[model samples]
Target: MGFGFVATQILAVSLPILLGWALNKLGIIGGDLDNRLSTLVLNVALPCSILASIDGAEALPDAGTLVLLMLATGVTYVIAIAVALVMAFLLRDTEDARVSYRFAIAFGNCGFIGLPVVGAILGAEAVLYAAIALIPANVILFAVGPLFFIDATADAGRPADRLRGVLASLKTPTLAASVAVLVLALAGVNRLGVAGQALGIVGQMATPLALLITGSSMAHYRPLEMLGNPRAYVAAAGRLLIVPLASLIAVNLFPLSPFLRAVIVLDGAMPVATLGALYCLKSGRDTKPMMQVTFLSVVFSVVTIPLVSLVL
Candidate 1:
């Protein structure tokens, strides 16, 4: 995409985020509505968006290319986890601090920020690649995600629980939708006719809805407090800067198309997943560390994501 196209796409995506923040601040939408809308976007709009992208695509990658994309994505995550482990040692103040660093750096806001931004800036075709990338990310997140925030020694975390999480991760709505769409596309079912039209209409909602939820979620966190954490700044640097740079080097080893290459770079460039904060809250862990990184990485990303686009 041209710089002009990227700029237009960023502005279009950024507007909903601003509006969502304003709406939450004014109490027009928050609490239950925000939660429900998040569910709607993740389960409905985002999946439909994935399907519609493939349905409308003029071309489809062969099964081998898709497998290669999955492996490339898996390698990216492995590199990220290794980076997180190394950084955790450098930041070893407390176990909690190490946990925060590892979690924040290793995973990204791929679904909420990466998906929409890629779709908007790179077109729907890129979103298909983004969807493919999500498979390995989610699998790793499930298999070992909680260990980042949950102490291995904690009594509350059982082996069975971890195994269940891994199994359940296999069934996430987004993953399910993505796999289903890929099968259909492979079977020459690209055009769903009227169903395709309906899906496209619903799919259009994913970007705006995901960003709105992101903005509204940000409203609940204290920006000044989030900004003041120097430790969080360290984590943000690893996430927003270090990880993307490392991902670029790692992805280059593969013979990927420029489109797949851009997807990996943009994926690495995204901010912390807002889901991480929610996970901390539900687990009764201190959410402050990740919330800070999430807030700062997000506020900084409007600039950084565009910068990463230049590399594409």
Candidate 2:
């Protein structure tokens, strides 16, 4: 069952790439479309997706399970960060390459890819647990993730700089949605009525639109060139295999429920976040290697996720 769901989700992620490739070939959409789609996904679709999934959660885990899942999520990221730093030093020659590689390894597409896969395999309750993971993931991605690109010229004099960065990161639409949904759920706002229905409609667009945008961006790259990067392969291995294996060990050492354990393990096995490369671009670092790692990790996770699922 886990394998079947994973196979279907992989196909779902890939189909948009094919569509984007075809559209690009026909001169229908360009880079501008990619940006527009990303904005929509981040600001609208993703938040709705979070709200839709969490608000309608039928089975909430116990407080212990939630605490355990959070711990596993934090530890998985710490290990990933350590692995990324070591891999960056050993594998990459240039500072930019090292920064990009480290960022790719440290983050995963836990929201867009993860929520759907977990929901499919472990059901809606598990998605709620996965969202708990996303809260910290977003914080780390926005705040500490950029520090990878900090060069000698970076200004660390002001404490306000770090605070401002964190504040800006927390203001994202998805985070807003996550918090809103949590509030609504706590307040017993079960029947969102028109708002819920509307969010559900928009939220459904997050995954396909995200996949399409990712595919469209990929259309510009030469597959042979991207695949030839050794760093990409190492990062993919770390993201798909090593991180999840570490997560499995951490979860097992605790007495967490099977469902909680499964959620953490599967999340650990997710591909690098598509936005990591974009973040690298924003930080004036190399995006090529980051993109390479993200694309290849997704390709490899088609196998790794299923195997990890079976093991769990």
Candidate 2 Cα lDDT to native: 0.75
Clashes per candidate (backbone, < 3 Å): 0, 0
Question: lDDT tens digits, residues 1-312, model 2?
Answer: 566776776666567767877787677865787788778888888788777776555655555655666677787788788888887888856788787788777778887677766765666566666777777677777777867777768765477877797788788887777666555555555566677788789878876776666667667778897899887898788888887887788778878877778888887678888767667777777777787887788767767877788788
User: What's the distance in Å from true for residue 93, model 2?
Assistant: 2.1
As a TM-score, model 1 comes out at: 0.95
Q: What digit string (tens of lDDT, one per residue) describes model 1 on residues 115-189? A: 989877887788877887787777887776776776566675567887877697678688887787768756766
| lDDT over C-alpha atoms for residue 66 of model 1 | 80
RMSD of 1: 1.6
**Top TM-score hit:** 1
Q: Which stretches of candidate 1 lie over 4 Å from their true place?
A: 156-158
